[model samples]
Target: MNGTSDVPDRPRRQCPGCMRTLVVDEQNFHKDSLCADGFTRRCSDCRNEAERIRYSLEAPQRARAKRERRAERRAYFESIGRYEAA
Candidate 1:
C-alpha cells in the first residue's frame, strides 16, 4: 500500500506583497486586493488602496490644483506685504 494516499489535499497560493504561503479558500485568500482571476495572489490592502486611488478624485490633478491655489494665495499675500521671508 502507498502512504501518499493519507496526505490531505491543500490549496496552494502565494501572497503578492510578501510572496508567502496563502491558503486558497481561506479568509485571507481573497478578502480584498487586485488579483488576477487565474493564479495570481495579491494582498487585500494593496488591492483596496489601488482601487481607492484609481476611483478617488484626489489624484495628481487635485494636488496640482492645490499647488496653484497656494501660489495664488502667496501672490496675494506678497502684494499686501503680508508675506514674510524666513
Candidate 2:
C-alpha cells in the first residue's frame, strides 16, 4: 500500500475569527505561516479581512515610500540633466 493510507484524515474545524465550521481541505485553507499545523487557523474570509486591515494600517507608510522613490528618481534625473519636465 502507498503512504496515503498511512495517514488519517483530519476533522473539520471551526474558524476562530468567524466561528464558521469549515472542512479542512486543500481548497478551503492555506498553509500555516508558523508551520505548526497542516493549514492556517483562520478561514479565507478571516484571512482576507486581516489582510485588508493590515494594508489599511500600512497605507500611509506605503504612500511615503512611493513618494520617496519618485523624489529620488526625479532628483537623479535632474542631476544628470537627462530628463525634461513633463
Candidate 3:
C-alpha cells in the first residue's frame, strides 16, 4: 500500500462566527477583495446571520444617521442658494 493518507488535501477554512468547517470555495463562501485569500472570513450563512442581527439592532441609529446626513445635505444646498423641498 502507498504511504499517502486516504484523505485528500482539500482547501478548508473555519467560520469564526459559527465555528463550522466549510470547504473554501465560492459556493460556501463570499469573495472579498480586501481579504488575504479574496474571500470573507465568515461563511455565507454566518455572514448573513450577522448582517441580519446588525441591521435589526442598529436600525434606529442607522435611521438617525441617514436623517442627519440628509439634513446636512439640505443645509448645504440652501447655503448654495438652491433651496429644496423636504
The candidate scoring highest on TM-score is 2
- Per-residue CA lDDT of candidate 1, range 1-86, in tens? 86568777877677667677766654555543555553336655556667797868568788899999999999999999999989
Taking the tens digit of each residue's C-alpha lDDT, what string does model 3 give over 15-75?
Answer: 9988999999899899999999989999999989889999899999999999999999989
- For candidate 3, the TM-score is 0.64
Give every collision pair in model 1.
32-44
By TM-score: ranked, best first: 2, 3, 1
Provide TM-scores for the models. 0.36, 0.71, 0.64
Candidate 3 Cα outliers beyond 4 Å, as residue runs: 1-9, 33-36, 84-86
Candidate 2 shows a clash count of 0
Report the CA-based lDDT of candidate 2 relative to the real structure: 0.86
Tell me the spans in candidate 1 whose CA falls farther than 4 Å from its real position. Answer: 1-58
Clashing pairs in 3: none
Better of 2 and 3 by TM-score: 2
Q: Clashing pairs in model 2?
A: none
Order of candidates by lDDT, top first?
3, 2, 1
